[model samples]
Target: MNGIELIVIAIAMYAVAYKLYGNFLIKRLEVNNSNPTPSHTMNDGVDYCPAKPPVLLGHHFASIAGAGPIVGPVIAAGFGWVPVYLWILFGAVFIGGVHDFSSIISSVRHQSKSIGFIIQTYIGESGKKLFLLFSWATLILVIAVFTIIVADTFTHIPSSGTSSILFILLAIAFGLAIYRFKVSLTIGTIVGVILLFLCIFAGNYFPIQLNALTWQLILFAYIFLASVTPVWILLQPRDYLNSFFLYALMIGGLVGVFFAAPSINIPAFSSFSLDKVGYLFPALFVTVACGAISGFHSLVGSGTTAKQLDKESDARLVGYGGMLIEGLLAVLSLTAVASMVNKEFIDILVNKGPVPAFSLGVARFLNAIPFLNISSEAGQTFSALAVSAFALTSLDTAARLARFMFQEFFEVKENPEKESIFQNRFVATGITVAIGAALTFSGQTMSIWPVFGSANQLLAALALLALTAWIAYLRKGILFVMIPMLFMFAVTLTSLGMLVITNYNSENYTLSVISLLLFLLAVSLGFKTYNVLVNGKETSRELI
Candidate 1:
């Protein structure tokens, strides 16, 4: 198929899955409630209040659709478009969407709690501890890699400093407009997004230069403030606004691809091309997580999203449908990367990272469009900047999630007595900064990349098993969840084991060995979790 036709087919498949499989999951699971009581029903205008569907969607999509959708597809395209397309369609519809929907629905039935809590309740105490530890460690890796990614993008040229500053100011202004002025969130978001685009142009006009150390310090300060501030004031507004930029960039790339109508020059498959590094199976799974499936979505579904859900039925729309949209984005991104020539493709893979390479492909596609007159340099800059924006959005979400995990792990009760919510926000901010600092300082950080992909896929396999067990226990259809869960478990385990053996043979001794060991630990824990859930005595309260 041609580029545009391939994209259309993928999107149509996603729509069918959303309507048929998504609906079936909801019905079979009996997620409908006659008198639906979302966790946000008790929302005291704080963390647990009913947000409008649009605002809630904006928040959820922004949080979930991070650098993964961009980075993974581009990197995977190195193998070929066939694998990338197949994995995204199958993975997103069956695996990613299922994990997302189940998580949100499960959290709503309980209270708006973290997935760790749900695992603890349903899986067993040991399961809970293991999941939480893995979550914390994985999140740390996410924050580290994404932080460097953001830093790299923002510092690509001396001028990006202005764009960074402008974004921070716009976030603050957007926050105040909503919180203090009581403006409609949608209206505020529109203005904030417009201003963000203006800032991009402003970056070109009024460039700022700063030393790397100075830039790091400034970025740290901005993130600290952003984390501590109220969601309405900064977090929600910034993310909501940034979502528009992300969508625009994505849409623009898609339009460019279609208009250019670039031919797919790469072969459907390459002969076990091991020169790029990493095993194909695990690497493919890892690179395609957001497009296919991701454990992180479960956390988001349970953490903040379940609360805002106005109705149980909305889970299909917000969770499953939203994932389908992300899947489309992945397909579009992959197509853009695939359209590039082999030499240009390898150059991008080697020099500017996967995201930048993908952007370069998009730019090349856009340059082919009639009447656009986009320059190569300009397209490259736009691609880089757009990536920086999206990557930062992901980093922002990860920082918040990490903070939540840290607090939960410490068992810090949500007490109003010790400090105001804003004070607690400051604590969260501090934790985020500390995470960034540690990642920045550690010279051993690069090793995180090789194993991060598999580690994430491993987490997805574990979550699927846990969710499937819970559903079966709840008297839902076991066949659908069971067979798929087993398949994923086997695939992930085999892939992870291969990765370990490969790394061991390479003997580039570092913390990667630690990551391999963690994968093994996850496997053992998974078996134990399955055994306990199957044979253990039932309790009134679920325990992970």
Candidate 2:
């Protein structure tokens, strides 16, 4: 198959799925916007604030998309593009879309609390505590690594550094105009988007060079403010604007594929070239989790998206639709590389990394434009800037989500007293980002990252369990939720088991022990979930 055919089929399938399967899932949730969302009912104007569908969708999409869809799909293409494509398509439409939509709706139904709190009500207090602790730790790791990554990118590509600083300023102004000055949405968006392009051009015209450490420090300060301030000020506008870069990139790739008509040069069904790539089953599933289904997406939904939801009905668009959009991006990423032969793809993969390979692929795509006479070098730079922007987006979003998790973990459940310091948003955000920054500068992110990599899919599996438990508690149809839940559990456990053995054999006892601990966490959660599914007649409200 050629890249054009893949793109066309993907677009059609995703559209149909959203119209048909998406509606079915929406009906299961019994979505009604009649009741005020937490954005209004629990509105504090900081975290809990309402947003229009476009704005929130942009925020949600940019937050979840990150460098993940680009990087994950590219590497998972090692298992072969055919398998990668199918998994992304099926996983997003079925497993990922359902997981994201269910999580958002469930959280919206429960006062826009984090999933950990939801698990507490349905599963047990112990479950909530464990999940939150695990999530918070993972998020800190995310914050640290991405901060380091974005900083490195900025140092290497000083133009992106210049663009990013201007980008943040532009987002803040856009947010202020829309929210504080009460500018109309249509006008604000027009101005914001036009200025966004200008910012990109400005970066290319006049680059600003800085050391990685300096860039990292600047990012730390930026994220600290991004986390503590109202979502309206920075998070919403920045992410909303950030989406345009990705949209443009995807469009360029698809158009290039259409015009270039590149055939799939990579072998199709080579899911397990054991010497080149590991076993296909669990490895591909976990590696490609971001574009398909991610446990982290659920956290973003419950932690931030839920709080900003304007209506119950918006969950379908922002949650399910967002995942499918990401699916397209995964497809685009796959197409970029799949168009190239195995030898050339592996050459760049080994020499530079997934990001560069993706960048080069996209460059080829855009350079296919004959009329415009675009250069591959320029296209690569454009793609790199977009990657850096999203990576920075993920870093800050992770910090804000971590702050939410940390505060929720510590807040008094039956509070009848004054708020504690830990519950204070400023204090919570400060501590969360601080620790993450410390880890990045201290050179400890690499070792702990492998642990999180293993735990990432495990997190998804546990989240699916929580969603399944919710379905069982409702006495509704469980097959849709149950099947995916089981598959993820098998994938996660198998991967973790492999890690345990692999690490133990290599005498990397720290990772081996940590992997074992996570293995146990998943097991405990499974038992609690089983009990809930079998005998969960009591209301979560009553349990609370």
User: Each candidate's TM vs. the true structure?
Assistant: 0.90, 0.96
Question: How many clashes show up per model?
Answer: 12, 0
lDDT of 1 by residue, 1-544 (tens): 6788878798789878988998888887787756465544666554565655666677788788887788888877777788888999898888788888887887787766677766666676666667777777777777777767666655667667688678767977976777678888778777777788899899989887666667666666766665555555566666667777777767777788788888886666764454655556656776678978887887777766786687788788888987888898888788887787777876878886787777777788767767878887777788777667767776767766666665555553454246544246567558657866787768567765777766777676776777766775685565565565676676667766766666678785554476567667777767776675567653232332
Q: What is the C-alpha local distance difference test score of candidate 2?
A: 0.87
The lDDT of each candidate is: 0.72, 0.87
lDDT of 2 at 379: 90
Which 10-residue window of candidate 2 scores lowest in summed lDDT?
A: 535-544
Clash pairs, model 2 backbone:
none
Give the per-residue lDDT of model 2 (tens digit) for 1-544: 7898999999999999999998899777678889789999999989899999999999999999998899888988877888899999999999999999999988988899888988888898899999999999999999999988988888988888888889899999999999999999899988888998899899879999889999989999989999998899999999999898888888888888877898999888665744433588778887887889888899999989999999988998999999999999999999998888899998988788898899988899899978757799989888988888999999999999999899888867687145888988899989998899889988978877766655877777778788777776776676787788899989888878988998899999988888898999999999998877656663332221
Give each prediction's root-mean-square deviation over alpha carbons.
3.7, 2.5
